[model samples]
Target: MCRWLAYSGTPVLLENILYRPRHSLIDQSLHAKMGVETTNGDGFGVGWYGTSGTAKDTPAVVREIGPAWSNRNLREIAGHVRSHLFFAHIRASTGSAVQQTNCHPFRHGRWMWMHNGAVADFQRVRRDLVLAVDPDLFLHVEGSTDSEVMFYLALTYGLADDPPGAVARMAGLVERVGHEHGIEYPLQMTVAVTDGLRLWSFRYSSQGASRSLFYSTRVETLRSLHPDLDFLREASDDTRLIVSEPLGDLPGVWNEVPESTYGVVQPEGDAMFSFAPALPA
Candidate 1:
């Protein structure tokens, strides 16, 4: 339903990750090779943490109800802003209105979240899902998209303290509610979330087949394989990118995230875990 990318590494201008790649997120907006739709022009957003002259914990976000490919504002921002961690998304409405509020990479405090799939029959169970959000956080639901609802649900379930557990609970609730509504295969998602210092990504769907998700091969390894590429040469060993699709065709530069799994990228190290929905208690 959508395409998204999350980058964490040496501080670099946004264009390096959002525009300069061979198959950038901007290119995916119009010619997505793996998304269900070829065009994700409904809307787009970019969220990044500021490194200097301002708060470093809370991110600055910009969104628009327009295609990223031709959005001069996005291009301009990409040219100048530098971040060590950031998220960018291009949307293809599964039915939601094409509005700025419905864009991906929704944010709250020091956290940001984005998704690439839909909640099956979302409109049928929207109220039930929305009601599950904490009343205090529910007030922040500015958009009517299922992705945004999913974010608040995770937050309500303790995403700040336990992201993986919180998300599993969120997905579990969606499936439980969907089944109660008589909908089968009630969830589909490849989600990314971060609190500036670390990022977590997951791929899962109730019916088994889920959206595409890939993580970049380590820069240290890629450098030994393709030292001629300046990008890898300049990148740090800890740099990481998790995306809905490979950004380029560089050999040994990407690996598919296994089915039913979640991962985290951080300075200490990175890891993958078997993931499953745990019915919320």
Candidate 2:
């Protein structure tokens, strides 16, 4: 129900990814090709860690309840700010109120999280999931979107220490609660979470038809494949992107993340790993 992009690589102006691409995230805010809706102008947000390692203690975040394509301040800030890890999201609210608080790439300390799909039958299972959250973490939830609730739920189940296991446990809880309410497919999501270091993305649904998710091939590989593409030339060898859809129509540059799988992108070692759903215990 939304579109988002997570970048982990060499520091570069935000606009290079948010605006310069043929179908950038800002363009997707108004012209998403694969989303359930073409226009995701409900709201938008950008979160990035600053250049100085000290700024990692305080990530720069700016969110507004306006169309990203038309936000002058967003344009100004994106053109100037530089960060190695950043997240930008354009919202298409499913059932939440349209406000800045409801925007994506929700943050907590050094960790940031965002979602592009919904927990099926959220209202039916909301109470159950909310009750499962640790009270301290529960108080941190300031919005009504299922996305934020899911983030806190992951934290409750130990996201910081073991992201994949915590997330899988959260999904298990959602499935348990949704089934109790008679919903056939209790979960649908393409989610990204990062701790200013490692990045994790998951694409899964109870029915096996998850939303679209993609990760770019290495920049060096793309350059060799399409040497004439200028965009490929500008990016660093290790530059990597995980998006709700391809940022541009560069064949061989983007690979679809298989359904029911999760991907981890680690820049320090430049490694990518895909994992299937953990077998039930």
Instruction: Write out the backbone clash pairs for model 2.
Output: none
**Per-residue lDDT over 1-281 for candidate 1, one digit per residue giving the tens place of the 0 to 100 score:** 99999999888999988998999999999999999999999999999997742335898899999899999999899999999889999999999999989997899999999999999999999999999999999999998999999999999999999999999999999999999999999999999999988899999999989999999998889989998988777788999999999999988999999999999997689999999998888
The C-alpha local distance difference test score for the whole of candidate 1 amounts to 0.93
Per-residue lDDT of candidate 2, residues 148-264 (tens digit): 998998898888898988888888888888888999988888899988877899988888898999999988888889999876677788788999999888679899988888878
Q: Return the TM-score for each candidate structure.
A: 0.98, 0.94
Give the top-scoring candidate (TM-score): 1
Residue 15 C-alpha lDDT in model 2: 93
Q: Which regions of candidate 2 fall more than 4 Å away from where they truly are?
A: 53-56, 268-281
Candidate 2: give its CA RMSD in angstroms. 2.1
Poorly placed runs, candidate 1 (over 4 Å): 52-56
